[model samples]
Target: MPKAYFEPEYLNALVEVFHEAKRILERRGITHPVAVDAVARRILSLAQEGVPPWQILGEVLPPMTPEAAGLPEVASTNDIVVSGPAPDTER
Candidate 1:
């Protein structure tokens, strides 16, 4: 079987999306892992569509919580490991 690969650009996009998702979750005061995971998945989908990392924050995420409005904004991208390419469904 041939080995699978995650394209560099795809990996980068996924990383950026994850970062943005984390920030949105933090700003919303969402500490639940499940909720954060759900947001991360959505961010990946949007990132796959070539949505800008910064733009994804405003377009796809839930509105900022009132309490979060007063919090200082922080942004950072972290490294992510993509185990491998998605399995082919055509088989």
Candidate 2:
């Protein structure tokens, strides 16, 4: 899908809010890339609707968690299993 565009003034504020939200999520241990990207997209959407940066920074970001950020609990490498044909022991 095409990326959303923003006015220069809104773009600047969106960038600032995006970074601040990233920092907040990191501090809260929501460091998953999906969560961070979701927050950034949300910030831009809200800004496009004319929400101010201060409100986005102060109100919109504080309550976010991994679930709130819309990311499912990620499985660790050890939790993932690859299925394949069994080895040929008779060879």
Candidate 3:
């Protein structure tokens, strides 16, 4: 069985592109254009770190508001706010 969230192969390919981009930067000794590729690499790294792809996407792409995380103000759920930490499940 797979984890509830799985990072796709295309995402891995993007990471590779970033890697290649970095080499180019180092070769040319110019990192001015590195920011975009660097950000891509960071998102890919986060995805590899076991974060859900959706979460990674949210961090990378824009128009992402606190609402998307199911925060109370957006979710219309008064019983519990979806913001803050994930609820403790110990009890």
Q: How close is candidate 2 to the true structure, as a TM-score?
A: 0.54
lDDT of each: 0.67, 0.72, 0.56
Prediction 3 TM-score vs. true: 0.33
Cα-based TM-score, every candidate: 0.48, 0.54, 0.33
**TM-score, prediction 1:** 0.48
Which one wins by TM-score: 1 or 2? Answer: 2
Q: How accurate is candidate 2 locally (lDDT)?
A: 0.72
Ranking by TM-score: 2, 1, 3
Clash list (residue pairs), candidate 1: none
Question: How do the residues 1-91 of candidate 1 rate in per-residue lDDT, one tens digit apiece?
Answer: 3222235745765576678678767766887999988777766666666665656667767575645577665556676767989878996
RMSD list, candidates in order: 21.3, 13.0, 15.7
Model 2 lDDT per residue over 1-91, tens place: 4334466756776677777787788777889888888877777776667667767776566665678777898766656566899778996
lDDT for position 21 in model 3: 49
Against the true structure, whose TM-score is highest?
Answer: 2
Instruction: Between candidates 1 and 2, name the one with more favorable lDDT.
Output: 2
- Checking candidate 3 for backbone clashes, the offending pairs are none
- Model 3 is weakest, by summed lDDT over 10 consecutive residues, at 1-10
